[model samples]
Each structure stands twice: as C-alpha cells, then as structure tokens.
Target: MPRSPSLRLSVLPLLVSCLVASGALAREAGDTGLRLLHPFATPTPPGAPNGAAYIDITAGEEDVSLVGASSSVSEVVEIHDMSMEDGVMRMRRLERLDVAAGETLMMRPGGGEHLMLIGLEQSLQVGDRFPITLEFAERDSVTLEVQVREAGEEGQAAGQHGH
Candidate 1:
C-alpha cells in the first residue's frame, strides 16, 4: 500500500528525533560529566625525575571526586596539595579531591592542588605532549592530552574560580 505524502512527512520527523535522542543518550552514557580545560605540565630538565601537571576541572550536575590519576610518562601519579604549616611549606598526597556539583576546581602550580608525576620515564620539554587519565569516584575515567609548557607559564590563569 502506498502511504500518503503527509503521513510520510510526519513520520520522518519522528524518526529523526528518535535517532538524535538515541545518539545523545549514547554520548551521555560515556560522558563523565567533567570538563577539563587547559591541561599542561611544566617542562623539566634532562634527567629530572619528577614533574607536575595542572588543569582546571569543572564538575557537572552530580558531585564527583577525583580519586587518583595515571600517566604513561611517570611510574607514580599522585594528587598533591601544598600548604604553609606554621612557617614551613609542606606538600602531601591527597587520597581524593572532591568536586562538588557545579563547582570548578583549579589545579595550579605553587597552589594547594596539583598532580604529582613521580619517577618520570623521560624528561619533559616545552611543547611536548603526553596522555594522562583522571579517575573519578562516580564516573568513568577521563584521559586527556597534557602539553608541556615553560615553568612560569600559567595556563588559564584568569579563569580560576570557585576552587
């Protein structure tokens, strides 16, 4: 049986909508709801055993915790925070860094939060890039490409907000 032109046209939009909605759902399933911005690492000298990577991460509607991280360039990847205790500076590993819903967390050098890459496999040079995976407590891990920049260069400095 031949269908009327009006019926076919109406069905087309429904079909298209279904396809679009399904695609959006598929993407939502894989999405961690975390956004990474301006991820970079400081260049290290030849034979330097350690380095750090910094970035800004924004949590989505649901609260998430950054529990750990991993990288191919370093044997040990740890979340660290630095603070002044009394008159001395101290840095320590963080078991987990929380990101509340709708909050943006900035990981900057000389600050309270950063990723510590220890036992580096090779020295990082300016313009070099590597991959690092960020683990979250309630979502799938996210892998990002990190660029190596000069030690004094701060990426996305003005955008720091909400910690």
Candidate 2:
C-alpha cells in the first residue's frame, strides 16, 4: 500500500514538533537540578582593587566542578581558597572547586573558599547588582544576578536563597 503525499507531509511536522518539545523538556529538567543559593558580594571601599563574592552551590544527582567565572565588573575572576600555614593565613587561586553529588559547597568570606574579583573597574556599593556567569565541567553554565550587600553581611542572614 502506498501512502498519500499529503499524509506524509502532515506527519513530518508532527514528528518535528514532538522531538523539539522533548529536547526542551529534558534540558529544563537537567539544568534545574543544579542551583546557586544566596549569591552576594560585599561592598568595597572606594578605589579598592579587589572584592569577593560568596554563594552556596548545591549540586544535583551528578558531581560537577566549577571551572571558571566571568563578570564585566572586574578585569578577572578567580576561585580562591584560604588556609593557614605556620599560623599565617594564606589565600591561593584554585584551578577548580568540586561539588560532589547531592552536596553543597559554601563560599564565604573569612572562611575557606570564595570568588575573587580582581582589578575592579568601579567600587562595588551596597544595593548594587551585577551579572556573573559561572562555568561548570559537567553541567550547563549559569549566570547569576549577584547583589551587593553590606561589608561582612552574610547572605543567609539576608534571606537571599534562590534556586
């Protein structure tokens, strides 16, 4: 039995639509699993050369590594970790920060880890917001709208948690 040309033409559109919709759904589900919680930066003094951003990154079902970050507000952004060596505090650039599956990595000031924004074009003030793109090794990159907070203010206390 030969199929009619009109019937085949109609079926093609239906098949294409189904495939497109399915792909969209899959991406949405996968991307939603990884989330940035309470992203914020502290206010910087006038003419300060550097500042830091803190956030809680919650990983999904699979492990992911934070490879890099970028922002227009600064000339360079780097992941850093603070530690004590011979009773002296030391900060160093980290190549990658790994977030294990079903785990959260907390980046906080005065803590162990944070994102260093170096060579600021302008001083960051309270109530200001900026866009930052976070790159990951095993998942899609996410752009976060980071809000500036008072110096030493914690994001958890300000209730800025988000998915």
Candidate 3:
C-alpha cells in the first residue's frame, strides 16, 4: 500500500529539524516524482555552520538514485543516512539512495537516509534561501533554492519534476 501525500507532507518539519541539526537543507522545489520536503535542524554546541536544508522526495514514475549534491554556501555536500540499531539511532554518510517509481521516499531527519552539508560559508537567518543542485542516476539534474526557517518550522514541500 502507498502512503497518503498529506501524511507525507506532515512530517516535513520534523525532518527539517533533523536536517538542520545534522547540517543539510532543502528548499521548496514545487514537487517532483522525487521531492525534498523540509530542512530539519540539528542541535549544535557552538561555532557550527549557519544552517542546513532538509527535504522530502516522492518518486513519481521512475527509478533514480540521489547520487550527489552541491551547494554554493558550503564546501562539501553529500547524501547521508540516519538509521537505527537495536532501538538506538545513528547517522552516517550514504553514497546513494534508490527511489522506486510511485513510492514516497522521504529524506527527512531521523530516517535512515538523508543529505549532508558540511562547513558553512555563510550564516543562516530565518527566512533565508540558498541554491543547491541535485544529480540523479539518469544523468539528469535539477537545482533548487533551499529555504531557511526557524529551528522548528517545517520547510515548504518540494514539487515533482516529471510526470
């Protein structure tokens, strides 16, 4: 069975919190077969990057891998994963993720899969937006401006790319 779109939309903020805290961000890209939902914020002790964007992706009708990511505000951007171990949660770097056609794959916080933006070059204030490029398996790509929100607010849902 498939999950409802609205239900998928609801968890975007919490995922955003996870991303921000972990150092990744996602802006509203309208919605794609694979979309980026929100930029969850992770807790930082001090002297951390300004902010990171979080996202949600719902693959519409094709299979793709979230191969690599790039952003101008940071030095390094890569796909990441946050998983559970014996009821313990942990985050790590992932090379890629497969998005099955018609499946609602979430790249939210606390999940086994996510994105990573390391070493910020700028400060992130509320209501800020930045640009990032996402590359897929078919050699196709798209660019989006990740919006920055408060530590708790969920980012706007991104739209699908192709039908």
lDDT of each residue in 1-163, candidate 3, tens digit only:
8879998766765654554444443433324445554434334334676344565565765666778888887788877777787898876777887777777675555465656778877665566567777788764465655666554444233333221
- Overlapping backbone residue pairs in candidate 3 total 39
**Would you list the clashing residue pairs of candidate 2?**
none
- With candidate 2 superimposed using the best TM-score fit, by how many Å does residue 158's alpha carbon deviate from the native? 5.9
lDDT of 1 by residue, 1-163 (tens): 7878787655654653453343221112133355666678998899989999987778778888889999999999999998999988788999999989889897777768999999999999988888788898887666667778775655443345322
Off by over 4 Å in 2: 1-29, 155-163
Q: What is the lDDT of every predicted structure here?
A: 0.76, 0.75, 0.60
Q: In candidate 3, what residue range of length 10 has the lowest lDDT sum? A: 154-163
Clashing pairs in 1: none
Ranking of all predicted structures according to TM-score, beginning with the best and ending with the worst:
2, 1, 3
Tens digits of lDDT, candidate 2, 1-163: 8878788655654553453344221112133366566677999999999999887887887787999999989999999999999999899999999988889887777769899999999999998788777888886565666778864566446454322
In terms of lDDT, model 3 sits at 0.60
Candidate 3 runs further than 4 Å off: 1-46, 49-51, 86-88, 155-163
lDDT preference between candidates 1 and 3, better one: 1
> Judged by lDDT against the true structure, how good is candidate 2?
0.75
